[model samples]
Target chain A: MSLDAVPVAETRRKGDVEPLVRLAGPDMAAVDALIVERMQSQVPVIPMLADHLVAAGGKRLRPLLTIAAARAAGASGPIEAPVRLAAAVEFIHTATLLHDDVVDSSDLRRGKVAAHLIWGAPSSVLVGDYLFARAFELMVETGRMRALGILATASSVISEGEVLQLTRAHDLNLDQATYLRIISAKTAELFAAAAEAGAVGVDADDATVAALRAYGLNLGLAFQLADDALDYGGQSEVLGKNAGDDFREGKVTLPLLLAAARTRGREDAFWDRTINKGERTEDDFRRARELIVGSGSVAATLDLAWDYADLARDALSALPASDWRAALERLADFAVSRVA
Target chain B: MSLDAVPVAETRRKGDVEPLVRLAGPDMAAVDALIVERMQSQVPVIPMLADHLVAAGGKRLRPLLTIAAARAAGASGPIEAPVRLAAAVEFIHTATLLHDDVVDSSDLRRGKVAAHLIWGAPSSVLVGDYLFARAFELMVETGRMRALGILATASSVISEGEVLQLTRAHDLNLDQATYLRIISAKTAELFAAAAEAGAVGVDADDATVAALRAYGLNLGLAFQLADDALDYGGQSEVLGKNAGDDFREGKVTLPLLLAAARTRGREDAFWDRTINKGERTEDDFRRARELIVGSGSVAATLDLAWDYADLARDALSALPASDWRAALERLADFAVSRVA
Candidate 1:
């Protein structure tokens, strides 16, 4: 667990996202411009609240996937359509984050104070609605109904996932399959749709589009699993949120579920009180993390994440070997490598 | 102000929406069917929470406007596109209601306990989002991008208006123009878009489409103005919500604005205490209502509504003579007449 115990070569083997970021820089800049231009409104609170989150900026990974998919799928001419679709995808993601913060009552997002906390929940909710509508407006401007449908369905599926999670997230008995389904719906679906819409926007062939969508889906699963693992094994400065947020909120993510199942009757009272009864303290979180880490649950989660990352990289075999494809392969490696 | 002072003929002259309801019945039935079918999801909570609102069923006036506009614009053939758009419009409206109740923390909607109360605020917010995504999915099915654009823009405008109202709702100094802007964005934009999308769906001529949009805008303005008046003047049973909700929330609608201006110095202290200070009692609401009514503010609000209604009726002159057109004119009249 100490830095001295870790092998230097293994840390060096952990891949980076720098290649994808460097390659997609120009396209992403255009997407960012579109995002900034569209989030503005005559109402001051809207732009102010929206910019609080949008300006702070995350990895911008979803839209980058969108643009990468378009180019990787052999988009040759002007990439304006894919660029706009990429912006729309970001808008949709931002909107969901706004609503999610309000729904979860989380205190931080993208390493900044949550928009809902600063502007109040009502403004956050309304501005979320505004961004969502603007996303569709951007899609409509592309005159691509198929891409619109993809994002629309993804949006619906995401909410359904959110509702399912809200209803079942506190259950101590939740199985891993249901947890995966929830993450697939809430997190992975948008990734898949973002890639699929980008391909569709570029008039990519059906096979190419399907392959990119598969890549996105698996990459999303890997990324989310790694994220879940990171919550327990990583630092707050790195995660942009406090460790044990899931534990404190009684949210039964994969790490907790795995640790619960592995510890079975041994930690019954501990798990029951913290998760089911929703009673916890600083010491309990420390103890819970100890158990989760001591059981090798985080390692098991990262291993599964690596499997998905491999599958994501394998999906790129369908495409012609190019810098975009190679970068995407590295990106998938980075998905799980970040947890290393 | 008593019943004895009201003219019998004027009571009879106040029009009703029955004609439009009856005429749009079959198309609305299809729209209703679509709404029920689309709101269903594997996530049981989604349908249950959505049904809690959708099943209570408001007047369906917005969707009816969509159908009526299509038919009145001389769509002689099958009106499938408009029917779908009508359902989409209702979904948007229902989604907003879900978010609005959560934002306002209201107790009732459509004579039922608010969805957020029955489920939870988190569930309500997510369900609203699900319905919104489903709305765009429905619009995508129609394959009319322009229609989609109209609804998308309206959705954005509605959210802007909502945020505006949320920030300014407690301001006693809110001007008439700003108040009108808020209502137009929050309440009337959907109405205008519903009718406009309907006409566009039916491939109506540019003039007819413009006229229907105008009709919808005016009707929505009139309907919102009347509803604001009804908060002070009408019964809770008839209004499907507590009559004084706006007053209790300190939402400075047109009726309150007019009353504040009329009372000026006399009720400045009362307005300051109730709205600005956010302190209220039963006696304060009663006294405020008396002041609003005694100053003829409700009547003035209704008078403005009547003007909009007349403008709505005038918009119908662009269409040919038909029962649909006549019913629409009556519907406009009913918007204000309900306050009588």
Candidate 2:
């Protein structure tokens, strides 16, 4: 069931997020309602713009993971703690998206116009700040100081990762280690914290807490690796998934790093022209996609993704036998099987 | 005497910040060192970019106010609480500056090239985030949960105000009440929080906390109003302060709002062309300045600023007459006299 060799399919597995959603189903609605309530303000634009993005569909994967982790650790406490932390995680995630779209000049997110596009960049940045501040306020409501510290540290690490990525833009020398480092901070930090915060909410033991953090961290790495591969053209024979047009944007993800590593710099300047200099044309995107697939970098990326997914599975070995734990195990499978 | 009719003077009064600094002098160094220490990280850019802006100094007025207020309220704690909160306040201010430059597309800040100009918009945005996150970390170190809540709420309100201003940009119909609302949230929230947090650090009584909050809020309003007037034409033959440029940048502050209110619809379209459309030239800035002065909005802005200064003075009437309280009272006078 290895997906490394898959040619062109890269859509999210339909039920990958569902198992966790169902496991955490009880608190999902409450988290969603709380998000809407906390984001409210007298400033009409605050709610209008926030709702526009918040309501737009995305798998509520992060919060679901938080709730599941909390439950899997045998926390029977009122469920309020996990619910609040889940909402806070969603706020942080949404806030980052708003800022990211502005930074990337993204025209669309989740199939709608980006918030920046609709509200303008200034509003997007400012509103992102609003959401960020709101996220902390929600964190404070949990009254768990340790959980607050985890989320706050994650926020800082994520910012540092973003800065690193920004500095490395168009940098042809980006290696696997550096790419992993960046992704770990930008993407994995929140995932790890989201799960850890839940465990903290329930007063999970240190061993269980560490296990949950590891689970989240490795799963995040796997998730990002799969995403990078999908962008380069991960498709199944039955599905011909759209190769995400990331190379054209000069994004230096894992596949691009592998592709560059394999090349001998013969086309370094040409790669530089499109990927580094941002002199992109439609023709360049097609050719870049061809290079990525032809070089077997797609397979390499997925193989690496599988390795992380395995680590994620291994992290759960110490957890107690429970339906929620089993669901988390299945979620790991979905993380790697996206391309299969 | 009010400085309304003065033209071209716009520097903060020389001793306004000094008294507070001297009063809080003991903790100032530790706060400075802590900021440099906490901002350090594995990511070189975090420190490099943070230092670039942090070192290119402003008055350091906010932190001084925090420390002074803590001391004024008889804070006998380790002084660590106020020091940490002071650093956090400064970080928040710095982070906002980084983001504000990107939103405003300004090339210069503190007479130095903005970090965005040196690095880029993405770095500016992300590093601002790093500082904001670091701010919370420092806030947590105080272990004064109530103080943390105050700072967190201020951060949210500040962002809401910024978003409100962004949404209201180029809006010619912005009224006095709305304009005040925007500045109060954008600028005054932090000032009020800084003083309130300092008092909270000392476990000050509810009455003392109220007094400090009121003092900071009115001082903030007076400071911002003077700043607004200073940008238009607040100067004297002796002071020769540089008229801070706001009109050319399309900011719709109190002076411009008043000026627009005074003008009839005939010139309204002309104002729209320059302010609303952001179509400014050297000649336009000059003309805008002339229009602002000719409308007598400058004097009116200062008159309103004096009202806030008086309120700030009245807020301290309840405090025990300490040297620190007198310094704060003098600070209000200096806020109004900056342009005189």
Candidate 3:
């Protein structure tokens, strides 16, 4: 279905994460405490630099997924294991963000100056490593080998995805399938692993674990797609990052690729000059955004994100009905509702 | 004892690694194969960048220590676990080297062009991450949680050490204790983990594992001390990197710290101009090297290395008499012999 088929007011009504946030609050508090405790090191700069990013907290959505998955999987006794795993999931996400800032030379993250700008690229790189290693240490303490393997493989896949993106950065001709593959690897794999690890940590049955993983994968895709759409249509103040960052960096996202395809022959020179040759100006980004919105690419991207969100909600059918399950379903809607 | 107390020829005779290399050749071949196989990825650049560093092979000393420690601890049946752990050790080391080159902005590594130069710094950072994740993947395959813990902790310590070094880069006031702490974390901790993980993987006793770890720790210190000395005294061709690289970068290594202290009043302006101010020139480097050597700082550094070498040999006394033990004893001496 296209975005035109749905009412804007109806879509906006579906976008709320309050249910999941309230349900996961106590567990997330534990996870947050663990994150703070583990990130501490005798090397003064490590915690200082790490705290700069961790403190300027984003949604903490990945770890929230871990905690929710564990609760949904019927974990009853002490959830110390899931709590630790959730902290680890956040550490891995933060670590990747730190490295990505350095790799992309980003100027802002979570509405604050990027860590690399304040601490220098060298410190950012090393501190990212420190957090990555700490993530594994936390997993080891959990004594869950399968969960460790899931995150380890996910980490490798994420890096592979990142390198793929780096190599294909400014290519205007990047196909839809390749773009999907890049995002699936770089973003969804971690989501899948985070949920799968939590289920496995609690010794959930195979069917339950697989279902949670599927849910996380689809949810992650929806979130990323919505994020890409927001970059074109949403306000920078609300988004916590500049709106034209993707266009400015010549990053090839689904919206840009779709817009470029829609405007093919007419805007070929414009696309080549701004994206391929990398000679962009303020006027160029403004015009590019107008072209993208006018071409209906943002609506198309949101439509695709809605499809993934529906799939994510469907994947929760394996679990018995509970408040946690309903909360997760709403969270999926929230992933796409950001642009509303 | 001072360098004058020991005859030069006697110390030279103690510095060969041939025995260890010859004995570990077969196992190292297996590790080399695993390294080559695991580094390959569908993303062409991952393997290409990884191969650039892996192919321009260093001594592979860390993994060899892993193999020898397992063998010395009497791992008899199939030795597959040790072999995999050895490969994991190598991957971890190579990953660190890739990041370290980017961090230091070095032009040469393992006697060849640094990987970051061929690819960009972004690629180098991500590829290093890929190898690191792959290292954990390898360890996960062996089902050795304790070994994973050891390597995981080592990885954390190494980054902390690197951050410490980066923050203190050009400080002429760096003391010997902090210098040792930096090298211990960045260099020696991996050596200790490599050996300790091997022993632990083979189900060796606590005493035996501790001994091997001690041996690795001392050998690592000796090797780093000798490397710091070589930056001032050794030939560039033999060293596989430019001599005076530490001086050029204003790195506060042990030899520089020693020399700076020895000529404190006499060469205050020279040290201040070159190191603290970072206004180094070719002539400045030459003069600094001359002062370091003429002041007998290199000899004093080598003397400390020899002391660590002796401690490393002494730690091996816990293991039974075996070819592996003898080879490891010689490897400690080889750590110091690089500058010979």
Candidate 4:
């Protein structure tokens, strides 16, 4: 289809894909189709549950990093490695989501009922396990021990991050350092591993691997910060979840932590009622949101996200100027700017 | 210490293994210490919950298979592989136990509280996931893909078997073949994998690996059958569980299924009260046990267990007359004769 004929809204933002879509020329369509095909597999109820998320249509940012990283490394061909790499990333993400839903007893995910709610907790748990195991099998079929080691280590870190989160839940005493540790383990580690292994999948050298890893790490941090911002900012529609869900869950994210710190003595009753006691009424959410918004923590959090996004861009500067590299640059913008 | 110094009561049974104990020597002590050490690492409430089951004290059959298989392969140094192997098997077993308790909503395990009962369901679920991930990492350090493959495949089979059990639950129409598949996947697969991987860890030859696998498989099947028989034979103390707990859970084990078949026209009411309706009272247990025993299914089940035990012994017949092999032969007898 001609670019002019494409739907304006369905296309990424105005500047979002304009530069990179031109740079991508032809391979981007193939990459997108490859991801979809790879996502389709028969694993009892797991595949159906996964499709709910995979097709719920979040930006496929991790796989994009993978393909972009492969291309930025100056490798060219109908190389199947990138496809498997993309599939592996998706699998890891899907597996984590399945477990996350169970861990949180979450009812809604991507604007749909969570897998655990739909399929029961046991099926959801086993399916998550199945996907993780299958992801390992995919990596093994790639014939790279380095890739296996990278992915396996990331999976362990992911689990650890989750445990850390579980431990810290409902604790209002949590700080930015602990929050950062959780995000790095829970989210950024997989992002870093995905980009690192994407380059490694094509035998990218140490320098390239390091660059892509840094890129993914920064981008992932920024991505999660933006997610926290969205949670408080009432960007519910684009984010595909309810506004103030985090506050309801009593999670002390950056905004809440900063707001609580700034108010210190004055909002002790608010913190006690919302965070510690978990008795958040609508008035509580409104008051909390107003407090966080008024304290400038929302913009401050966004500032940090932008800083990380800029760092992510800087990490990509070492790579050659290619369409894939340009697409990655656009991705940092999309990740930080999206309501989701 | 000399063999005579060890307790005679622990070695006087029909399947007694004074020889294997002597061969194991100090290593048996080391393995036991490691088991306790590893079990203690489950942090706070988890460790307390795990201790309940650990102290309930299984035969440690899977770990013993690991040790014996390694020894049978003529490995004579650095028992870490066996130690690690045994630990990994226990971790996998413990993980499954946690999941099984959740799936079955089981209140008692070995006459003690289930992990889910002691810890909340979510905590039990995550701890199970933790143990599984820990087990994988430990096995991965072994650096043998074949061993990892065996274990990963067994884990998948276990999940599949559990799902099969779920789907077949309360369905009295289930046949012998499906029942065998369920048990094979849920029980024997892990046992076989443990033995085979133990052999693989020590670089056992193909023939030895095959023999150990068969031995473990037969022993596991025999062990489960004996457990089923005990449910009908008034051996609650030996099993560390209530007599006819399987019937209470609406599980149609070999003895129950055979009796149902023999009961013919009476099967409908039995099925209604037991499997389908699931309103099993003390009287229900009494009548079920009576029917199973009176129909001679318990004897038939015991015969089947003996057949597997004999097969396990025959599998070891070609091995050189080593103390380890002799211990394994005795283990086959013990597995069937334990009545649990």
Regions more than 4 Å wrong, model 4? A1-57, A78-86, B1-13, B17-22, B25-57, B79-82, B110-112, B232-237, B240-243
Candidate-wise lDDT, in order: 0.90, 0.81, 0.90, 0.74
Model 3 chain A: ten consecutive residues of lowest lDDT: A1-10
Q: Between candidates 1 and 4, which one is better according to DockQ?
A: 1
Candidate 4: tens digits of C-alpha lDDT, residues B1-340 = 1112212233223675455667676665666676566555423554565666666666667877888888898888776777777777887788788878877778777767777886667666666765666666666666666776777777777776776776674577889888888788789888898889889888889998999999888888888887778777755556666776788888888988888889989767966677777878878888887777777778778778888888989988767778788888888888766552
Q: Per DockQ, what order, best first?
A: 1, 3, 2, 4
Which docking class does model 1 fall in?
Answer: high
CA shift of B101, model 2, Å = 1.3
Candidate 3, overall lDDT?
A: 0.90
TM-score of chain A of 3: 0.96
Error of 2 at A261 (Å): 2.4
Candidate 2 residue spans exceeding 4 A from truth: A1-15, A234-242, A265-273, A276-278, B1-15, B234-244, B265-272, B276-279
Error of 4 at A270 (Å): 1.9
Report the C-alpha lDDT of model 1 over B220-300, residue by residue, as the tens digit: 999999899888877777888998999988899887888889999898999999999989998998998888888887878
Model 4 gets an lDDT of: 0.74
- TM-score order, best first, reads 1, 3, 2, 4
Which residue pairs clash within candidate 3? none
Answer with 2 or 3, whichever has the higher TM-score.
3
Error of 4 at B319 (Å): 3.5
Chain A: TM-score in each candidate?
A: 0.97, 0.92, 0.96, 0.89
lDDT ranking, best first? 3, 1, 2, 4
